[model samples]
Target: MNKKRRLALAIGAGVAPLLVVTMPVSSASAHGYISSPPSRQAQCAAGTVECGPIKWEPQSVEGPKGLTSCSGGNSQFADLDDDSKGWKVTPVGSSTSFNWRLTARHATSTWQYFVGGNKIAEFNDNGATPGSTVTHQVNFGGLSGKQKVLAVWNIADTANAFYACVDVNIGG
Candidate 1:
């Protein structure tokens, strides 16, 4: 080969690896999670509860729709489903506000809340993109005492939802 061609080839080979290394990695950025009243994953993220992987990615408890588990059926975040893990309980009235913090807001279909297998409240967004933070007024329906409320964020375009569980003491 010619001298100029050989030098150019050597430089190209060396720079190719560097360019690849410097490229930004595409990862699934975290979505949303219940922030107010401190969901199970929220407690882990805030260091109020000792947990496993969910502590690092509190907003990533994503799984298929219609799931009832706090981990969203994601085994990696199963720590959220452990009721004995001593999650912090926030005291509130019969009606209270639940807040969400979103890292990446997607078009949302509905926001559902449940307690003891019965749905208590739901807010329909009609496939609209939410803001960075969202809030909903939830009524406990005369329910009192310590309760574990499961919150689910249903995505509009996908058959997936994010999950969070908040422990609360109502009318305490």
Candidate 2:
């Protein structure tokens, strides 16, 4: 083989393994995030909410279940837990739809929405894999003013869950 061709082949051979190893991690972390009602992470992803490091990878706010933190208890994206970041909320009414933009869907145990520290809506996937998009109709009766909605996506067969905090100004 020619020297230039041989050198290019060597470079490709060296880079192939690295790309294969990193592919899964990139795909897994690109899974899902709340799209509608614009979660803190979503706003960051869309550049609607100016943030720190989280602006780069908004779909990675995931951690163990039973956590109440908005950033899914993950410190790498701790900016999601900060309310002072000026993340704007999509004004909502008593009932609104939350859309989950799932780039990689997993077998879901359930989806839950919490406001005022209470679950206002939930959906059981029953070990069924979710579609590319999952939407939940959440009702916030008697809820007023500005509120933070903690949305959790429990992955079935795993101890981890994805979290998104969608802030909203309630009206009607």
Candidate 3:
């Protein structure tokens, strides 16, 4: 009953699945790097939302745990795909009903949501006109117990500058 086993058990018994994967907080600069790979399993507790493991160059590096923000823009919980691009698959739980939300800044942007590499939904944001935040919500359909939910935000092709990304795994 080491740490990992204990964590797995705790998560299984909890209301929502736990994020068991953890990544290094700091690392050297690299081009087109992934802040938090999909392996870092994290839980989305009720009333608690966790941002993504962001990856970007040095200057725009500003966020929780030294997660860098892509310069010139920012997007949070924008799901990513298998290619490590801004589109990935996410699993869901047997709960069957949930709301997936995303937040982004800097002009108009697109937020893409997917489950197991399939394009399931999309969100749009037209930057704030009066210093307001842009938030998008979509229904979590066809999700089952112990499923994965991958949410991605496509800030801009020219520059990465993303805010955050997260996957909420529900059920025991």
Best candidate, lDDT-wise? 1
Clashes of 3: 32
Worst 10 residues of 1 by lDDT: 21-30
Candidate 2 deviant stretches above 4 angstroms: 1-29
Output the better candidate (1/2) by lDDT: 1
lDDT score of residue 35 within candidate 1: 91
> TM-score for model 1?
0.84
Error of 3 at 4 (Å): 50
Q: State which candidate, 1 or 3, has the greater TM-score.
A: 1
Instruction: Kindly list the per-residue Cα lDDT of model 1 for residues 1-172, writing each as its tens digit.
Output: 9999999998899988776655422122669899998999889988999998677778888899999999998888888889998888999999999999998899999999999999999999999999999999999998999999999999999999999999999998
Ranking by lDDT: 1, 2, 3
Tens-place lDDT digits, model 3, residues 151-171: 444444334433233444544
Q: Candidate 2 lDDT, tens digit per residue, 1-172?
A: 9999999998899988888778646755566999888889888878987777676666778799888999887777888988998988678888899999987788999999898789888899899998899888888888998899999999998899999999998892
Candidate 2 lDDT trough over 10 residues, lowest sum? 22-31
**Which of candidates 2 and 3 reaches a greater lDDT?**
2
Best by TM-score: 1
Which ten contiguous residues of candidate 3 have the minimum total lDDT?
39-48
**Clashing residue pairs, candidate 1?**
none
lDDT of each: 0.90, 0.85, 0.35
Give the per-residue Cα lDDT of candidate 3 at 84: 42
